[model samples]
Target: MNKFGVLSFLMALISVIVFLILRGPNVNLLLMAIILGSLSLLGIIFAVISKRWLSGIIGVLCNSVVLVSAYFTLLAYGIAG
Candidate 1:
């Protein structure tokens, strides 16, 4: 198991969970979303560098989802604000 792969996966998983929790009530959190999105982007980079293919792919997919959701949140609040 590649260390970076596992790290990226955990980072993405935590970001997703935190996003769900924070956005559950549709909180207007542009800064928070941006921060999470950036963190997830880092995770994606780590995923790409990871040697374990399976974990790396999963990390990429999960981080991608978080990235999309973060941007969506940004769009929703940024325009509305």
Candidate 2:
């Protein structure tokens, strides 16, 4: 994998860790989720453009996991209302 792909994978991993650690509803947590989601998406884009399939795959998986978890948690708590 290229440097960009590696970087992207790392960012996605970090985002996943952050999401797992902050498991409650709060404005700051929401903001962090948005930022991390953006970063993970950017990394996936870069990795795919760089032809780094492995890193891109990893990023996609990590981002998907975080998004799904966050969605379910927020929905279960009725935070959006």
Best by TM-score: 1
lDDT of 2 at 44: 62
Alpha-carbon runs more than 4 Å astray in model 2: 24-29, 73-80
lDDT of 1 by residue, 24-75 (tens): 5657588768778987998999998997789888989989988988888788
Give all TM-scores, in the order shown: 0.82, 0.62
Clashing pairs in 2: none
Give each prediction's root-mean-square deviation over alpha carbons: 1.8, 3.0
Q: TM-score of the candidate numbered 1?
A: 0.82
Query: How accurate locally, in lDDT, is each candidate?
Result: 0.83, 0.66
TM-score (C-alpha) between model 2 and the true structure: 0.62
Q: Which ten residues in a row have the lowest lDDT in candidate 1?
A: 19-28
The most accurate candidate by lDDT is 1
